[model samples]
Target: MSQSKSGCKNAQAEFSRFAKPLVDEALAHAAQGEPSPDDFHKLRVALRRLRTLIWAWRPLLGRKFADLERAYLKRPAAAAGEARDWDIAISLLGDEQTKPDTERLQTARRDARARASSTLAAADLKHALREMLRRVNRELNTSPRRTPIKCLARERVRAARRALRKRMRRAQRANRGDYAPWHEVRKGAKRLRYLLEFFQPVLRRRESRRVKSLRRLQDRFGALNDAVATEHLLGQHREVFADAATADAALAALKRERKRRRRAARELLG
Candidate 1:
């Protein structure tokens, strides 16, 4: 078949190959009655990767549909992240005077897990995921006019790279007390990393080599995020602690860690 007649690179087959395992992973973990903290994290990763994949194809796929698909994937990941965030808080609270807070975190984690499981297991999300894939296949198969596949991939990956660089600069210029800009840089780094990996086949050697640096950036940014998030989470529920002093101590430790991590992450931003 001519290029215009069948413009996509067997996108239906590629789409299934990339998306099915993630769907299966999500459903499998969702089915577990008592999914572990790791399970919730894995589910979040799968959902996040699926969202990134959709965004990577946006250059070829219509942006409106791609945006809608990404939004659809966001809910399950957010649900799963609630559980995962509690897990992060639990780990952050050291074995000092955190016994009380740890117990509360565990309770919150259990609740979040149940909610995540229910959200994932519900027929609506599953149906939506299936329907999204079907629509992707239909669009790819029937769209007569389309961008060249490799060109499309290159444009998306390069655009992600440019966006990441811009974010890093903005984050670097942010005040030491303002964490929001830094947090945005973290997200941008992740998005670029995922896009590069997804379109590696069409990437230049130097572009692919940048993954190592991106991984290091992620490590630093992730450490800072964990500490800051733990602090924020604990601060929000401080009143729940039976002893006010215990909450103070936990927050104190988290602040120290957050400062240290913030410094480390800032070094990377520069």
Candidate 2:
């Protein structure tokens, strides 16, 4: 084999080694008729990690193709996210769990879980995941553009870091009440963290050193997301409550939690 072909095969082999377990884990959970919280979480996480891997390879795969694949995966991602959000919101209710509101949320959670399970079971979704993997590996092995994997990894990881720094600046300048920029910051940070983790073997020692800080950043940002996302999810059901007063009380609780979590997230940035 030519040098490029040999290198490409090596890249394909290493990536498959890393990706196959995640695929199996996701597929195993998807096959379950009724998935537990942990199973659902695993399914969601696996899908996201796969998307991150796609992002890493987009340089070789072409951005448009990568974007399309990610978009196609979003339906299952959304369903799983909603289910997880319901669980988080319910957990946030804490001592209020005995109240009727908690029961209402639990009922919603059941529906969300069923939807996620249904999405996971969809023929198209299953085919899509498998096809994505097959196609990606095939391209890695056959594509004429034989970019060295190490060079690609370094370039993309550095670009990810730059993108994250830009997002952080935007978040810092954002108004206290406006979380959109901050949300972008959180996503950017997550993408960078994934890139670093996945490409660490090929990246410089300095790049690997950022993992600890990235973990801390992801934790703070994720806490903020939990609060904001829970509030957003619960807000949609404002009219579901039989009594307006109870609905107001439930929502008020979420607002307080959002406020508290946002503070911690903001403090971390400063």
Top-scoring candidate (lDDT) = 1
- In model 2, where do residues sit more than 4 Å from their true spots? 1-13, 97-102, 239-242
lDDT of 2 by residue, 1-270 (tens): 443443344454556766777788778877777888888788888888888777877777779887887776666877778778777776765644223354665677788888877777774556677887888788777767556666777787888889888888888888888989878878888888888887766667788899888888888888888888877876787654546776677778778888888887777676
TM-score of predicted model 1? 0.89
lDDT of 1 by residue, 152-257 (tens): 6677777887888998998888888888888888888888888777656655657888888998998899889889888887788785466888888878888999
Superposed Cα deviation of residue 66, candidate 2 (Å): 1.1
For candidate 1, the 10 contiguous residues with the lowest summed lDDT are 3-12
Model 2 lDDT at residue 101: 52
